[model samples]
Target: MSVWRRYLVKDVTGRLVDLPSRLFDSADDGTAPLPHFAGRCVELVAAVIVGDRVSHGRVTELAFTKLYFDQLGYVDAAKRERMIRLMLESCADRRCGSHRQDSHRQGDCSRLAHRAGAARDQLSREFGWEPKPDERDAALSRLDPARLRAAHREPAQTLH
Candidate 1:
């Protein structure tokens, strides 16, 4: 097991990009402490903001949860709910794209888009916002084959 102290730093939440980078670093260590876990929370917030424009919210969220679990190991229902709610709020403005490049070959591209669209709608409803159907579809369509493959190849736990 690798020592995790090198990833530790204090009073850095206000720095946006540095936050996620720190979180990403800590996540690789399996023994990050509670305060470092708190830092990961900061990273999650900043990541939601930075990734909003680039469609990486889900990716960041997965990492956030992993570090959260690493720090606390087990959180009760109330705390877990609060964290999830915070995540949803931070990412409320972002859209997730699930464009499928293999759809044409498999004739299942529409299904992929539909599933992604439905997930988006569920997120919007949970956050008390109307889902933008057309905009989401357009965004998915804009995802080129290369991007889709990259997204698909990402860790399954890294987000949708």
Candidate 2:
């Protein structure tokens, strides 16, 4: 695995507090890099929360956690709802490719299952409503990664 991957998987300290400095240090002209490192910080934070071994930084803060989840496509109220619905469906006894792999490899299932449940709870708390059955079905039907990606690209207005 590459250094970034290793760092992500093994480094318990999620302290990238100096990420700004690290990213800016390489810029001789003082201009921030494209795709801004600050923007990527959110992704890293999400990755850490999703099981990457990053532990130094605090991820529980409302602003930072919200930013990270937003960048990961969980901030849009609709998307978040859809994600939770999909998770609930996946949690059902039905079998599928992803579920099969997860069953064969418990580690993946544990991480994914934990993350899904957590995301669902987080959405429920934010939205203040229990998930409806139709919403659950819609979420399950859209669980395929390709379909989800396409939905994300659609210009549909987000609830958030």
Candidate 3:
């Protein structure tokens, strides 16, 4: 019996690009680049979370964790833990600068927070990778209410 799977990736332009199953088959046989395929998977998840919008770095980290969880079979426990640490560190780093603030709106933060929470829950439940209290707090803090309010208030300045 043959099992078939279909994959879709979101391009930088936000278009949903369907990846051919043959690409996976080729990668399995060493005829295609695994890194490229993995990069596409990351891009796919990132696109789902942020669409065409420019996202905060933490948003991308959450998306990466989501992708990793979705394809747990491909990742070992050690690597998964490392990725989790990297995600938390990236999220906890507060020097995100003005680009992050300029890019995200309130709705974007809500979506990112929702997805990050889901990823955290799945990590704890399935992988036995419980995040530290500070890490958890840092992840949640990425969805700053002040930043959301600032983004919300920006439109008012243009309302003249």
Q: After superposition, how far is residue 11 of candidate 3 from its true place, in Å?
A: 0.9
Q: What's the number of clashes in each of the models?
A: 0, 2, 0
- Arrange candidates by lDDT, highest first: which order? 3, 1, 2
Q: Clashes in model 2: which pairs?
A: 14-55, 14-56
- Backbone clash pairs in model 3 (N, Cα, C under 3 Å; residues 3+ apart or in different chains), count: 0
Clashing pairs in 3: none
lDDT value, candidate 1, whole model: 0.35
Off by over 4 Å in 1: 1-24, 34-107, 120-160
| Candidate 3 RMSD computed on C-alpha atoms after optimal superposition onto the true structure | 18.5
Clashes of 1: 0
RMSD of 1: 15.3
Instruction: Evaluate model 3: give its TM-score.
Output: 0.26
Better of 1 and 2 by lDDT: 1
lDDT of 1 at 49: 19
Model 1: lDDT of residue 160:
23
What stretches of model 2 exceed 4 Å from their correct place? 1-104, 130-160
- Model 3: weakest 10-residue lDDT segment is 44-53
Write down the RMSD of all candidates, one decimal each: 15.3, 17.7, 18.5
* Ten-residue stretch with the least lDDT total in model 1: 1-10
